[model samples]
Target: MKRNKYLILILLTWSLFPFCWQVYTSFSVSESILNPISQIESRWTLDNYIQVLTANPPFWRYLLNSTIVGTLSTVLTILLAIPASYAIARLKSFSKNTIKILLLTASLFPYVLLFLSLLEIARKLDLGNNLVALSIPYAALSMPLAILLLSSAFQDLPLNLEEAAIIEGLDLWQRIRLILIPLISPTLASTGIIIFLFSWNEYPIALTWISKSELITLPVAIARIAGSSVYSVPYGAYAAATVLGALPLILIVLLFQRQIISGLTQGAIKG
Candidate 1:
């Protein structure tokens, strides 16, 4: 146990080294992009965070756009996924392989292949480079994972509880609403946090769909910092923005850590 503990500590040190360096670099203001050597060679200042927070392009707008898109996308995806998962787990009206195939189809379908089609759909729908377009693709992309998770949650739930509810004269909706949903709520929380983090960190769809500067997500804003000058990028601002963008996910992970780990572990064990 002692040896295993030491090994885990060593692994954790290696894992956290880069993030520690980033936190260090984020406080450095030297013109040399705030690297390890720069940390050793120069003095620390708060200017980088200040510049990142107050720069003309304004990082806050990116935060807002990302938050809006991430939130809307996660919520809509979870809502859509819940019913689909319920049907798959409870009804089984369709073949299980067919359900799996549809999920795989949703996930494996190349987004790039359908880019222009999605663009036209976005334009026709008048969603137009904001949360709507970002959310649609994000919802589509995240649906598979959500279904897989909630379906597992639904299946893990003891059928006895469901049957008892039904025996009490509760119909399908009441059984699901009063029994299944409550039982699976922890799993739902886990899935929501997972989906939120995925949506929050999504990059490709954001780049493809969003055009206007004000509408661009934090990832795009951070990319703009990479092009701060015609040929040069401020790695300092890039690193800082990365840390900022990750802050939300960090808080969310911490909040959901227990339930997320429990649900995933239980699901894996069951599967």
Candidate 2:
């Protein structure tokens, strides 16, 4: 019992530590974040958030950009992946296995290697300073996993239903629209939420490519809290922004928890 209690305490601390620090820091003034020995409770103020949120470019704009990018990326990813996943699942085509392998292999490959290439492409396309650049990378990054997940859901569905529909002279589109989409919706939703989180939290790419301050995402805006210059960063506002940034994800997970749980648990094992 003692061991279990200790382990639980350790896990809770590990999980909550960052949030705790963020909350403590967010309430801290700009001076405290810069000072190593600053007392946590002594430096509380609303100025950091005020400064961070109302700076020349503003944090609210960045939050909006993040929302747009995350939402659009998730929507587009689902739209594209759903049809492709359905095709791969149902069509026993010659190239189906190869496509799946390629998707898996690409997903396994680290995104680090392609950063330079993506950067170059972004510059050429004039997408470097815009949210569009991040959206493409986010979609590309998520596609492989989406395919794999959606494939499982599709496979879990009994083939007889498909065969029956075909026998009744239902065309491919009809079969997909009528039969597959409805059955595998939970898994599809899971893929969408996962992709949205990836897009929402992506920081490194945003840092490198986003030069216009107006195009800042939440992560980059929060980074500014630590100060790029020798100037002090406001910790409290950064904490608030962090909380604000996290709220959507929390809601999404909570809202979909049941479906995600049921779908993943009952998902198809065999193709």
Candidate 3:
């Protein structure tokens, strides 16, 4: 038990060390970055954050773009997944395992493999540089995992409850709206959060699809900030922007952590 505890502690430190260093760097004066010990002695300032916020492209605009894309993608994924999951969970038309495998295989195909084709399709469809356009691919990419999770949650629910609702004169949509959804709410939240994170952090897709400054999402904007060669790279500002970019996700997990945990672990026990 002691060994396990020590191992966990070591792993925790290893995972958090880089973030801690970034936080330190965000506040440290530029000259202090090379000398770790001098970080404590150097004057700290909010100038990094200010610079990031006031940059030509504007940090808040990138944040807004991320929010729009992530929220829309998650909503679309959930809407599409719910019926598909219910059909898979309750229907006996085909082997559930086979269907699940096919869905997983589809999702496992690397996004990079589809990149060029998707970009061409986007241009042909006049979706290039459109925020809503980004959501389509994001939703498609995340659909499989969302469907899998929702199917598991739906399967875990008692069939008798659904049958009872049917006997009470509730139609299919009514039963799903009032019965199954409430029971699987936790799983839905977990799935939505995961999809949102995927969309929010996606860079390669955004980088390829969006060329206009106004449409750029946070990840792509941050990458551009870090890669700027026109001016000396502002390490402090870059670290601060990274922290800002990550803060929303951190707060979201902290807020819904219990639901996320419960949703993921719901079927682990067989009793």
Candidate 4:
């Protein structure tokens, strides 16, 4: 038991070291950041955060943009996945298995491979620089996984409850709305969070779609900060930006940890 505990502690520390380093670097003076061993009088300062926040267009703008995209994408995924999953769950075994297999294969395909084609489609649709429109691709990319998760959840639900609803004169949509969704809500919560996180941190697609400075997502904005000057990178400011960018995701995970755990546990056990 002690050995297992120590092993878990070590693994956690290893995984968290990078984030801890970013936090430490965010507060440190640039000189101290550049020379960690040097004994400097001003080892820490708030100037890094100040610089990041006070920059033109402001740091929070990127965060807000990311939030918008993530939220919209998650909503779109849930809206589309629920009905599709329900329909799939009701299909014959052979047909259902084939569709699930196809979705799984698509999900396994590298997203990067689709970038060029997606970019072309975006241009044809004139979706470039549109924040709301950006969510379409995000939703599309995440759809397969969402469908798979939601379908499995729908499959795990008791058929008797659905039959009972039907006998009570509830239509298919009504049953799905009032009965099935509530039962599989935990899976929805887990799936939504996963989709939101992906949209929040997505870079390549956002980079290609959003060229406007004020409209850039968090990842792109941070990348710009990192690459602002190749010769003398603003490590402290970049660290501050990274830390700030990570804060929302950390808070979200902390706040919804119970739902996340319950949802994932139920999905794993039931599915």
Candidate 5:
């Protein structure tokens, strides 16, 4: 038990060390950030954050772009997954296992493998430098996991409720909207958050797809800030940007931590 406790402590410290360093660097002056051993107390300032937030390109715009893309992609993923997962969970016509396997296989392919094909398709569709274009692939990429999660959540639900709703003249949509959804709300929230994070942090795909400055997402924007000039890298500003980029996700998890944990555990264990 003591060994396990020590192991947990070590792992926790390892995971948190980088984030702690980032927070420290964000508050420290540029010189302190460059020299890690420098005493932060004498060199601390908010200039890095101020500069990052109020730069000419504007940090808020990047945040907005990320919010839009992540939100739309998550909504799209849920919209597509709900119907498909419901059919797989409740319908008798389809082979659930086979469908699940196919979805998993589709997701298993690395995005790198599909990057060129996606780029070609995006160009052919005239979707260059567009958030909707970014969202298209993001939605598709996140759909498989969303479907699997929703399917498991749906399957865990008692079929009797669905049958009762049906007998009461509730159509398919009504049954789903009124019965299944309410019962599986936690899972839906969990799935949405996961999809949002996937879109929020995606860099390679966004880098290839978004060429315009205005269309750049937070992750891409942050990367650009870190390497904005050929001569110098702004370590202090980079740290601040990294912290700001991660703040929203941290707040979200804190707000819905209970639901997220319960939903994931239930989905995994029940099905």
Candidate 6:
């Protein structure tokens, strides 16, 4: 028990070290950051945050844009995934296993490889530079995993429950609406949160799809901070931007951790 506790402590520290460093750097003077152990009279300042907060379009704008995109992406993913998963869950075992394997394989593929083709499609469809339009690709990218997770969740339900609903004169839509959804709500919430976080942090697609500064997402906005000047790297400002960018995701995990744990636990147990 003592060894396990030590291991957990070590792992937690290892995981949190980078974020803690960023927090420390965000408030430190550039000189202090460069020479951490050196005795410096002036070691801390809020100029980094000021610079990040005062930029054109402002740091908060990026957060807003990311939130919009992430919310839309999560909604779209869940909407499509729920029905698809239901259909998949109702399938015969052989076909279901085959399709699930295909989905798992597809999800394992590096998504970056598809960006060029996706970019061309975005241009053809006039989707570039539109934040709302970005949700489409985000949903598509997230679909396979969402469907797989949701299907596992759906399959975990006993067949008699839906059969009973059918006997009660509930149609397919009614059964799904009144029965499956409420039971699977935790998995749905967990899936939506995961998709939202993915959309929030996605950089390659966002970079290729959004050119206007105001429309850019958080990841791109932070990248701009790092590349704002070539001569000097604003490490402090970049750290501050990173901290700001991560705050929303951190809050989300803290707030919804129970759903995340419970959903994953249920899925694992029954999948």
lDDT of each residue in 115-187, candidate 2, tens digit only? 8888888888888777876788888888888887787577668889989999999998898888889877777
Error of 2 at 103 (Å): 2.4
TM-score to true structure, per model? 0.86, 0.80, 0.91, 0.94, 0.89, 0.95
True-vs-predicted CA distance for residue 172, candidate 1, Å: 2.1
Q: Mind giving the per-residue lDDT tens digits that candidate 6 earns over 141-209?
A: 999999999999899899999899988999999999899998988888888888998999899999989
The sequence of per-residue lDDT tens digits that candidate 5 reaches over residues 1-271 is 9999999999999999999999988988877777868765678899889989887579989988999999899989999999999988875536888888888888787878888998899889888898987898999999988998899789878989978988899999999998889888889988899999999999988998899988899988888874458778888888999999999889888988888787767768866
Cα deviation at 24, candidate 2, in Å, is 3.1
lDDT of 4 by residue, 1-271 (tens): 9999999999999999999999999999978888899987779999889988987789999999999999999999999999999999999999999999999998888999999999999999899999999999999999999999999989888899988988999999999999888888778888999999999999999999999999999999988873367578888888999999999999988888887788778757865
For every candidate, C-alpha RMSD to the true structure in Å: 2.8, 3.7, 2.3, 1.7, 2.6, 1.7
Tell me model 5's lDDT, rounded to 2 decimals. 0.88
lDDT, candidate 5, residue 35?
A: 83
List the candidate 4 regions with Cα displacement exceeding 4 Å.
265-271
| Residue range 132-219, candidate 3, lDDT tens digits | 9899999999999899889978888889998899889999999999989987887998899999999999999899899999889998
Across 141-189, the per-residue lDDT of candidate 1 in tens digits comes to: 7889789778867876888987788779999878878888877877898
Model 6, which residues run further than 4 Å from truth? 226-230, 264-271
Q: Rate the local accuracy (lDDT) of all candidates.
A: 0.78, 0.79, 0.88, 0.92, 0.88, 0.92
> For each candidate, how many residue pairs have backbone atoms clashing (under 3 Å)?
0, 4, 0, 0, 0, 0
Residue-level error in angstroms, candidate 5, position 87: 0.7
Clashing pairs in 4: none
TM-score of 6: 0.95
Model 4 Cα displacement at 186 (Å)?
1.5
Q: Is candidate 1 or candidate 2 better by TM-score?
A: 1
Better of 1 and 2 by lDDT: 2
